[model samples]
Target: MTEPLIELKGVSKSFGRHKVLDNVDLTIYRGEALGIIGPSGTGKSTILRVIAGLLSPDEGEIYVQGVRRDGLIEDGGQEVGIGMVFQQAALFDSLTVEENVGFLLYQNSNLPRSRIQDLVKEKLDMVGLPEVGHLYPAELSGGMRKRVSFARAIMSNPDDPTVGPEVLLYDEPTAGLDPIASTVIEDLIRYLQCLHGVCSTYAVVTHQDSTMRRTADRLIFLYEGRVQWQGTVSETYNTENPLIKQFLSGSVQGPIQVAG
Candidate 1:
């Protein structure tokens, strides 16, 4: 594998009595597409949040580009910029798509509105939504809203190019969408990975089978707060791991205990 971009060593997280991550050790290499897959409530999304620096692990170290992160993202010692695309397409209902996409620039930078708008246009066009900038979040369909969120996630300030996201964390990006909509998001995920000046490395948390197959080159199965299996997409089909078999086949009789 290429040089590691992010590493989680002995990471553990819990909310009260529920442990979401349990001494997990994982690595994300530069330019790799990694998919985190598992049944519901298996801490898939929690891992993404931890990687994105939104949440600090209870008992482990997070090294981004080899520098240990001491606190949450707001504490600001991280070497690389990390962005997150939430599952809910979390856009402001009152703002136009343009405003929503350029929010960071507007709030943090001194760039003029026109300059920010131009940058927003560039990102929107990249996500195949050049003309929807003037529309509200409610005006677009689920897929379109998700694309807008993509544009927002990739939005970067030109004055500080180094601060732009080098790695993106996606949490259930295709969760509520239909199969066709999921495909669109999946295609965009792969497209963004190859697009110049955008995030080339990303970790997507997904339960959708098609999304996992199309967006990720490598797969990690998380169950009961630990990584149960890791392999390529092809290996996922050929492996005899009972957890993987039960997951891929949607069978209730295997080792994976069905949640009541």
Candidate 2:
């Protein structure tokens, strides 16, 4: 089997009086595409945050490349770099697309301005937005903004190739877009995976069925802060599991309770 890139052992997280994750254990292997899916408020996004080291689990351990992480990512000394693409494509409205994509390099790296611009142009082209660098986030369409976020997530400093993300966490990359636009994002996800230096391993937390099917090789179904079912995409369609059936069918008559 491939080496495990990230692992959550007996992880649990809570917000105020509510428990968002309950003794959940999960693993993400190198070079794999994983999907986390479930009803709203089921802690899918929370898991992604925990895995990315953005949120330290209330109780449990996170292992990156077989080494236990001592604190949040900001504490430093992590062997692997993990990047997250938020659901809303959280770009700064004030920054131009070029500035947004290369924000980290511009602020942190000593690279010359011309070099950073060249790198930004390369990433924008990778995401099919070579000319939108001068445009602001407000001017781009929803899908275009999402793509720009992708460019940012994959951006790396040329000085330190290892600084690039080895794994990516995506929160609803296809949400709120038209079907055709969603397809475009899905295709781009697969396309980026095929690139030589781009991230091949990623975890996607999404409620969109089409995105789930096209982007993940393996799926884990979460409910009530726990993983209830796990299987491949084909098994997702063929299994007799009631939770999967109800979710895929969007029916109100099943083990899953309607939110309302």
| Decoy 2 TM-score against native | 0.99
> Which residue segments of model 1 deviate by more than 4 Å?
none
lDDT of each: 0.93, 0.94
lDDT of 1 by residue, 1-260 (tens): 99999999999999999999999999999999999999999899899999988898999999988988899998886769999999998999999999999999999899999999999999999999989989999999999999999999998988987667999999899989998899999999999999988999999999888988899999999999999999999999999999999899999898888989
Candidate 2 wrongly placed segments (more than 4 Å): none
TM-scores for every candidate against the unseen true structure: 0.98, 0.99
Q: In model 2, what is the error at residue 141, expressed in angstroms?
A: 0.4
lDDT of 2 by residue, 39-131 (tens): 999999999989988898999999999999988988989978898999999999999999999998988899999999999999999999989
Cα deviation at 51, candidate 2, in Å, is: 0.7
lDDT of 1 at 64: 88
